[model samples]
Target: MVSSVNNPAIAMAEKPPSLEKEPMADVEVGIAVTDEKDDRPGEGFGEVSDLKRGLKQRHIQMIALAGTIGTGLFLSSGKAIARGGPVGTVIAYTVVGLLVSTIVFAIAELSALVPLSGGIIRPAEYFFDPALGFAQGWNTTYATAMLLPSEMVACAVIIRYWTEQVNNAVWITILGFLLLVSNMFFVGVYGELEFICAILKILLVVGSVIMGIVVDLGGGPKGHRLGFQYWKNPGPFVQYLGISGSWGQFLGFWRVMGSAVYSFSNVENISVAAAETENPRRNIPKAAKRVFVRVLLFYITSMFVVSLVVASNDPGLSKSAGDASASPFVLAASSSGIHVVPSIINAVVLTSAWSAGNSAMLGGSRVLYGLAREGHAPKIFTRTSRFGIPYVAVLSIGLFMVLGYMTLEDSASTVFDWFQDLVSAATYVHWIIIAIVYLRFYYGCKKQNISRDELPWKSPFQPYATWVALVSFTILLLTGGYTVFLHGEWDAETFVSNYFNIPLIFALYFGYKVFRKTKMVSLEEMPIRRFIEIYQDNPEPPEEPKKGWRKLNILW
Candidate 1:
């Protein structure tokens, strides 16, 4: 709809007379030609354009699929089951799935209407408060940077299941190089890479479920009919931290929430790539709607199947392997005397970790680029190459990939635990901020006498879903580390990992707020009417109708 001023942090001072008469083809998407510039607090950077729109509809769809499946599902699953028990684990994941899907739906409505590049961070600033966006942008950047190393470490650790002969450093170095090289290319290459990886993950989940069902039905090499047999033995619930009965089972279920959230961490990432995607207003909504189904099929169903096929008390589920070898799928296959399945799962999990690393790099770098465009970060981060890759931001994030080497010193499982705690908390904070931002935008519309039905896409349940998810996520975040308070269970690492992000986010938000002297804008000043005009002016091109099988994309 507009040029560089898409980010209200940096408003346009003047528009060229020709802009009103120019056709869409004659104008560049975000490259402003006017000499006039706004002198706002964050507006010193010259006219800035968006990253190239190289990712297509298929790329977006597969990325959406891939983001929902990661090391959290593949490796940490056994841990979740071990802690939460089979039944408790399933229930925890199901509840979290509902909460996360609600957040996704709310974001879909916001992004489809505005279609900005920074995802939640952009909306936070535009409609709520600029300080909130500053905090969220960096929180996302930091969390994603941390996740990159975590994924890289996961890849390296998975390699160890094959052989300990090679040093972990060697695997980390080689894979880190691949990760950097992959991001250095055009954005479409990254899209294609993720598409292929997503397909492999999907196939892995499907094949594992089928194998699990067969094994449970006494169709495997060993004729064992495990029709909820593990449920009977393990008794369907774990007593975590020596707490007995219902309370322990509840704690067990609660522990799984962090892991489940981690598993679904990046599902909201489709919007992070909005600026680089074609027809984002149309494609993003399509991608977002599919995120719910992908989460259900890949995460919910996989957890149920894994819990059924493997007993939570199995000794082989031990964390000694520190990798996917401990995954419930591998444990079940190995226990059933199907030795080959472990290696197959090992390979697929390796790709899943690497795919997640690539996706994190892209998402983190884009957020940094967006931050720079908004004058929240140094302008150097906005520098792009001829092919439109943000080289500076990529290199900045790539430097943190070295954190993967920490696995060489500590056990991979231990390192993974640390990353998981930090990331899970950060994920909660980010989601909480999303709820706040969405509520502000929603109420701002009502306050401005704007109609929700007039928006490009509107989610059901309105402000009610927003409030439910907001309260639920806040409660989850506060209690994420409840176990640390048990009589003998006081762990500094665990406490810091779970709660550090709360204060950190607060500091970042208020630190920016005080330094910038930014005040929360009232609904009247949110510019809701102006943004609606922008959306109306830049209506997305009509999407080409899908062909025969292409229509099945909705089933993701």
Candidate 2:
């Protein structure tokens, strides 16, 4: 189970030993991750639970919102509209939503049962194909590589609203620094900050939806209810899924899908956080059950309302090509004849970007630590601050923030665009792995004689749903690139962008296998129970590190 802000929760199953309660003065410098093998935090990335479960309901509230909101919806929504038109896009979203929900439910059930820090990806090694785990873990990390910049660029762009007088790159630099600094402090602070920003993100999206609804309902300027005027006026669906959708349009949805993919990059955060929650068995199940509700009520509901209020035919819809300027949410607010609302929305959306960047940094860092703990990465990444924060991983992951800012360079948009496309395309590859993993999970349950009653939460439509998800996801990705072909504006960029996903997936799998000579850990060799037993030995957490400037001594 891993959460990422500085590094989203990267919780793995393991045990604890008594923490060193050194004086506060001695603990401030930072903790150096040693090769200690007593099954503590650094016992080869054993697990993370250094802090208290002080997060309130609001924290969970924002985490879910932050997970779903941000650059994806605000910026990517318009692209979906342009491609799918009103009808096709609407249908696509609904379909994707349901399938994703099903996967989430399955993830929830397994996570509640396993409660591992590595989340679904780690468990893939156990429940599903071990090869599936390698794929998921590696791709998840690489996806973050692409996604981190996507978010930071959006954040930089959003900041432009406050002061257009300033050059965009300046904003990128500032925003990048802001997020990097946050990560340096540690996961707890990162979590708290993300908690606040996530809440704001939700409020902004939810509030905007309510506003658009009220205005559309004849509550705004001149009693002119916007209603679904555009929907009907344009004839239900403006674009057709076939010839009506066009190549350019349909490919556009892939971009939006990329953003949506990012929103859920760490969807299994609760599983990671479970290892750190005050009470694992109790808190985890509750969070798992609630995750579905949060997704529907927040993400789908907000997107649905916004799509309704603003007709897909609107010119603003066309411009959104998913660039910050193209965000339909901001444009629609502007169109409503509400001036301040647009700026306010922009400000909040800025939070979404910054918050997302925060999540990226947090998640990526833990990934580094996880890999290091597994002996897949360098030992340096295992070092932690005196406060139990993984310092090296934090800094290593933060390096990407600087590179993320480079994408903001105007001259680099093409390169950035390609990078973005490549990143988004990774989604199809990822979901495929997830599907594969789930498929394996089903058989693993049966082969291992694990019963439904033993499951903490059981996904409905199993076996069947797993097949449906895998098949549909494959079709969507296969057809996705065809949209570009249909547009007749096809080029290397289009083809490579759309097709590279498959190769990238293999590259990671084979590349790592060759280097590590890694083989799939099969059912008999799976270490799930071994990991759980280790943590069971020492239950009491180490005392909090003392707070001081020079006294920082990180326990690596």
The candidate maximizing TM-score is 1
lDDT of 1 by residue, 1-556 (tens): 2323333432321222233523322121222332223331111112224467788888987787667887788888888999889999999998898888888888878877656567788777767767788899998898887888777777777887878798878888899899888888789989989989988998999999999999989888988889898898877998887789899888888998999988888788788867677777777778777766777888888999989998888876657566667789988888888989988988998899898889889989888887876678898998888887898999999999888776554567566777788889998998888888899889988987889878878887879988999999999999999878888889999999999999989999999878877667567556566545446655566767889997876533
Model 2 Cα lDDT, one tens digit per residue, 126-149: 554334455656666776666676
Worst 10 residues of 2 by lDDT: 23-32
Q: Which parts of model 2 are misplaced by more than 4 Å? A: 1-46, 49-58, 127-132, 240-265, 272-274, 320-325, 408-420, 514-518, 523-556
**Each candidate structure's count of clashing pairs:** 0, 57
How does model 1 score by TM-score? Answer: 0.92
* Model 2 TM-score on a 0 to 1 scale: 0.79
lDDT against the true structure, each candidate: 0.78, 0.57
Q: Which 10 successive residues of model 1 have the least lDDT summed?
A: 39-48
> What's the CA error at residue 429 for candidate 1, in Å?
0.5
Indicate which candidate wins on lDDT: 1
